[model samples]
Target chain A: MMNEQRREFIKKTALGVFVGLGAASGLVPAFSLEKTALPVWDEKPVPGKIRWGMLIDTRKCKEGCQQCVAACHHEHNVPAFKNRREEIRWIWKNSYKNVFPTADNAGASKEIQSRTFLSLCNHCADSPCTQICPTGATFKRWDGIVEIDYHRCIGCRFCMPACPYGSLSFNWQDPRTAIVDPVTAYPTREQGVVEKCNFCSDRLIKGLQPACVEVCPEQALVFGDLNDPASDIRVLLESNVTMQRKPELGTKPSVFYII
Target chain B: MKSRKLLWLVTFAAISLFAAFYLFSNGEAETPQKPLARVSVVDSTKCIAPKEFMRANHMQVLHGWERSVVRDGDRVHIASNGSRFQKSLGTCLGCHNNRLFCFSCHSYANVKPKCWNCHLSPMETQ
Candidate 1:
């Protein structure tokens, strides 16, 4: 009986060691190693995986409404300089004729000629600004958004003229001095860098919509993933006729307007 | 000839004594006292990392964070204890809000970081 008891104890000890080894090796799901992974700001943006685009319904957009421009400027801490040459603007309005010069304009209405259109960075897929930027400061993000790393910009105006749309502005003087009311959420650009709309990439990372889109009372602006067929912007594109600024330039602009 | 040799030796000895006196007097001159680096924490709480680690390598951590936040677009930094913090100078200023917290050490070390050129410091905000 003592001999049997010794044999039983040996069997139990061997089984216990086997279980411990299995746990250590992660063979058992409950014993898997727990890693403290960082809270990622979305997955690393992959090219063509998500193309963030915007659709603006020009019909609903009011003529005198500066809410979108105000909201964008305030959120980005874009200063308003007294000199027009030294002024910085992210988003602004322009006459339809100026915005869409290539579009058929022979029989356009009087109101159409006078109508103002929202103008900002096109965030083009084949952007000339990104191509001409000597420093990799201004480039297209993997998700199809054009962004500028102000820290990397060398104040070269190569991107300014390369862009068909006058979307970029240079900070000739200290922008902080001109800021009427500064917003601490975003940083202001230094005196010697080109600034423009970033499509609010900062907000997108925080799971918030763009400031302009959120503040528009008319809901005229629609932003979504262009790659997703089920996205609201895509649905709007499918149901309505849309126009892109300077489509002939082959920039492949992501911003669409429903006239 | 012996008298001339003695006169030359006397001249050399006089020059040597003057040079030694100048050197010793310069060495005894008092140097200006070094400015003391004093940091007062506005919010005294547990830091993201150990005090020793932060004191030794805070610059490295900030630079690593700058690259991650600006270039890679990874804004969240998870501490060893699993607490999440935004990877910005603002986060550091949130706790060490005293005006001299950064400047005191930076001035003491004679370093001039250009972080405030673009980013607003607590002093500017106030």
Candidate 2:
């Protein structure tokens, strides 16, 4: 009888101790016995199920129009440098010859030769940048978007050269000094970290499209889940003759150019 | 015997002088007043957690939030009070907009955090 009473006492004491610890650790509400509601702002990126991709219709992109570039830079607080050598860009226009050297033809029409293509991070499936990062700072997200964790990047510049697209930029000096009308929404990067287009992961979580896609005057850019058959990007990809940059390299870029 | 007595006398005198110097000199020097952190403009009760908990584990909380929001893309933080907040420094600065509050406490503690190096502090906006 005494042993039974002792067992009951011990079980109750253990339960009380667990509850106390939980309350102290802020895992459980102290006064309120009600369960806390889990407020989800957006859907979590599930690996392989949802792959975010982009389709850029280069034919629709107008010449000398940098609205998308300007919007991306401003939205991300990318510093402007007058010196071309020191300039940083998340997205910029490059000549077709430079962007797609393998596909370029000298005998092509002047319109095709001089045509500019919007260039940014390809966010490759088998990305060399993510593979070469020594610190694992550059990584492919579960949603197929490649991104860098600024906190983990050691400024080794390995990812910069590993990325064949030249999407990454290093902060040589204090970026804040060069920023004009700084956007408080995004944190400015410190010197010595490599930063690139995050596909606006911050905005994506808030249920907003990428800044470049949203600001495109001609609606040349389309962003949607590549894995979803019903997604707009998938429909565009199916209907158009899209080309990935340096397909020979087997990067399998998510950003496709509808030439 | 006389030499030993002389040595003891000298030792006693030195001890007496040292004790007197320490006690008197300490009282003569005025201790600088430590700057107190100003209370945040918002009600203290509105904090995500209790005042004592936040005061002790704010850094841990912030670091956890940073990792989850940036790396894992978990943006929503559910507070113990069932209030949801976006896991960003902007959310904190929205209410505690006073720069003096942060600086005063940090200066007093002699801890210089590099959060403001990249993040836009309330000081910069003001």
Candidate 3:
């Protein structure tokens, strides 16, 4: 009889300990918790607020100047390549047909024959890259810049493939070997991280123009807030024949081209 | 009977203490912090020309005949009719003269012209 009582007590004690552990280890809370709180913004977007964008005048873009491409590559510490396959560019000159094949064949008059295009990130209003990211590593800032948090990125390369314009590039090797001293405006990313044109967001925050914009000799590239009707970009769009890349994709790209 | 009860009490106390220690240690594990994202920008003030001047005259300054002579100095001197040349232009001569080399490689590859696509003729004489 005494052994029976001891056995019963031991069983009860063991069961109690097991239950306590399961509760303390978060197994119970996992099934019973509410949603986590996220950071919220309260400011209203001004009607004429800046929605920074770029306008490339393809007619004036010289075929081989490569000044914009070289400047962007050097400033961003983009890797050099021995072949076309390894080439990575944040901003590059593209042919009129390469960037806008449909438009090129639209039977426009010969007056538009001189047109060629420069291509880069569109900085879309409703970016699909941000939507497909498993983690919130890629996000669009309120100011219309699409940015990536490198440390949070798991190097899935999803963003690279998802981008319609081929704007995003994955770091196949360590980025450090590309430059002795990387640009201080942005921190350098490591191998396996994805990167692209950020519309020079760090410069925008500092009240400076993008490197490509400042360096273009033809004034082919114009950047300003789209939300502000009076901004230079808006004014230019009103005066010139402008179009966006891949408008059917419904990305609502902020980058425009004036032919 | 008394001894049996006393053993049960001691076992329960020990079990409770062990459970408390396990819970406390598990709670002390550090949570990882998220890394901040970084963006880069160029300093306009670092350039030699004013922003407006640089924006307007960059192509002319980059692609003129003077730029070619400045870039390939050895070739220029060898091809020259006389030994004595004019004055030294500066380091900008070497760095800004990348077009000759770049264009040579680009031409060999039969790649589409990159310069004339986005800019006008660099020579004021043109």
Candidate 4:
């Protein structure tokens, strides 16, 4: 019995020394992370795996609230022109009648009928802009985002006309002179090139939400992977019957409106 | 003959005066016309490359970064020293702006980079 007690004492003393040494220095990590497992972010957009999409809950989006539109334009350094004709817009509002031509009914609710639908690049799956681009400057990514390579774009404005949604805005003059206080380091577009909403592709690379979506006070915008069944956008689409602008064209627009 | 000699001397004096004015006026101005840089002193850790290297070949490096970012879609630049950086005007322009750092050498060289046509310098914004 004495030998067993002595053995226990030695074991306790060794454990105490081990614990004391561990406490003296952080030899053992407090968080207890697995050394073998390296945390890999790799959030960068990969083609064919993630099809990013958005659902605008129109009910939550207040009329005359141009927050989303203004935020996008500001973030991208989109020019503001005095004349309506010369103005460049990445996102803007249009009446329900204009956005959904065939769907508008005389008997429909006045609230939705008169509602201003936020519009931008549809980022079509089978984008007509990509198909029409002579220089292959406007090409659709495998993840279904239609992006414009300004370097390659000859500024022929072929993609401008091809887009049925009228999302593309051409910079008629140097955009730098227009913005009074440009967003620092944001690229101001040169004259003659067509620019449009890229769905915040730059932000997406760093795993950040779109500026428009982030600025919306009403939480109207829901952006996520359309392919991911568990994504908020997918769940929203499943729960609510959403509508896409001019769906009959079969461009497979990534944006959905919950009207 | 003295009158003709005086006339030639006066003409030479006027020509020299004009030449001096042009030479002095065209030289690099000590005080930059644009807004001053936000910070004056730069530490070695402040920049990715040494100041000498950046001053010499920033254009080439920037163009390469632009191609990788805009065309090839490689946004993040990982340095050999294991530092990761996102290649955008916003990143560097946050500190070393056009008015102070960029134009100091650029205006002196009389080379107009097309970067201003697209990217907004902090001075333009303010």
Indicate the TM-score of model 1: 0.75
Cα lDDT of model 1 by residue, A1-259, tens digit: 6435644554677744432332233232221111222233523333456778999998899989999999999989999897888879999998998889899887677777888999889999888898789888997776678989888899988999999998999999889999888766678889899999999987776567899999999999999888777889999999999999999988889999987
Model 2, range A1-259, lDDT digits (tens) per residue? 6435644554677744432332234232222111222223433434555678999999999999999999999989999977887788899999988898877476557887789998999999888898789878998776778989988899999988888899999998888899997777788888888888999886776557999999998999999888777789989889988888889987889999977
Q: Which stretches of candidate 3 lie over 4 Å from their true place?
A: A1-49, A109-115, B1-126
Write one digit per residue (lDDT tens) for candidate 3, span A122-199.
988778798778987787654667877664678898888788888888777766566544443234556777878878
By TM-score, the better pick of 3 and 4 is 4
The TM-score values for the models, in the order shown, are 0.75, 0.76, 0.53, 0.71
Candidates, ranked, lDDT: 1, 2, 4, 3
Summarize candidate 4's per-residue lDDT along B57-99 as a digit string, tens digits.
8888898878766655655555566555556655566445333
Candidate 4 lDDT over residue span A186-232, tens digit each: 56678878889999986665457999999999999999888777889
Report lDDT (Cα) of residue A242, candidate 1: 94
What interface RMSD does every candidate have? 25.5, 23.2, 32.2, 23.5
- Model 4: CAPRI class: incorrect
Top candidate, metric TM-score: 2
Q: What are the candidates' individual DockQ scores?
A: 0.05, 0.06, 0.01, 0.06
Instruction: Kindly report the root-mean-square deviation of model 3 from the true structure over all alpha carbons.
Output: 29.3
What is the iRMSD of the candidate numbered 1? 25.5
- State in Å the error of residue B52, model 4: 6.0
Kindly give the stretch of ten consecutive residues in candidate 3 chain B with the minimal lDDT sum.
Answer: B117-126
